[model samples]
Target: MDMTGQRTLQVTQQQAWEALNDPDILKACIPGCQRFEPSGDQKFAVAAGIKMGPVSAMFNGSVQLTDIVAPQSYKLNFDAQGGVAGFGKGESSVEIKPLEKGCELHYTVHSSVGGKIAQLGQRLIDGVAKNMAEDFFKRFEAELEKRYPPAEEPIPQQSAPAQTSAGVPVWMWAAGAAVALAVVVMVTR
Candidate 1:
């Protein structure tokens, strides 16, 4: 399947990049993720429990970061297996752009499933994937707020109280893209 989207965040590109690569932040933000232990440089051993409809499974996976261009973009390769439930392998890319107030994250994923998961109708699988994507972003956004709350601007005591400009922060998490599909498909079949 092929998917693409972007989100804005109230952080500098460097801040976004750092958080995206932080193991602790990723483990906390990923839905159903049991562990996100770093196995080596730019590599992680991941375990996540996923539920799709009535199916549920614990997926064990590994992810590698490649083609990195610090604070700009990078490519991620991921694969996972869930016993009889199925398996998935894919490559994805995330590009970060700096904005005046924050930054934007753009991602594109190309992945394939095998075994029972491939047997599931594409429509159903796609629907589930999309929903999972949205859920991942929502959780990532909340985590960002909790971990890196935006600084509050002081109100001017002059003619008018200064108003803080609220940037449209879609929230940035490169890790969000890396594991979202790995976990979502763990239970598909």
Candidate 2:
């Protein structure tokens, strides 16, 4: 499977890069993730519970970051196993571009799967992948707000939603890919 997406973030490029690399933030942002710990330089051990359609399983995996360019971009390689459910392996590239207000996160993923999960079909797998991505972003945004609240400004008569401030790093992008891959594995089962 292949997937691509982008998000507008309410934080500077530097800040987003930093947050993305933080293990705590990544762990929190990845839905159903139970563990996200460093195992080596730019490598992490991961365990996540995922559900798709009528299937669910616990996936154990590893995510590695490569071709890293600080506060800008990186590539992620991920692999996960779920016993009888099946397995997923993939690579993703993530880039952060500065914008007038904050920054944008762009990512692309290519992955393959096998085992019982593959029988579930492509449409189901794609839907689950997209949902997992959305869930990750929501959690990531909330974490950013908590860690770095927006600067206080006087409220205007017409109140607008206050923007939160934060950042992400290359590692975070890797984590996102890991989460997406894990979810895909679950769907296949």
**Tens-digit lDDT string for candidate 1 (1-189):** 888888887678988888788878787767788998889888999888876665678889998999999989889999999899899788889988999988998999888887776777788778877877777777676777777887976644576433334532222233456368335521110
Please report, in order, the local distance difference test score of every candidate based on alpha carbons.
Answer: 0.77, 0.82
Predict model 2's lDDT versus the native. 0.82
lDDT of candidate 1 vs native? 0.77
RMSD of each: 9.1, 11.4
Poorly placed runs, candidate 2 (over 4 Å): 155-189
Clash total of candidate 1: 1
lDDT of 2 by residue, 44-85 (tens): 999989887777889899999999999899999999998898
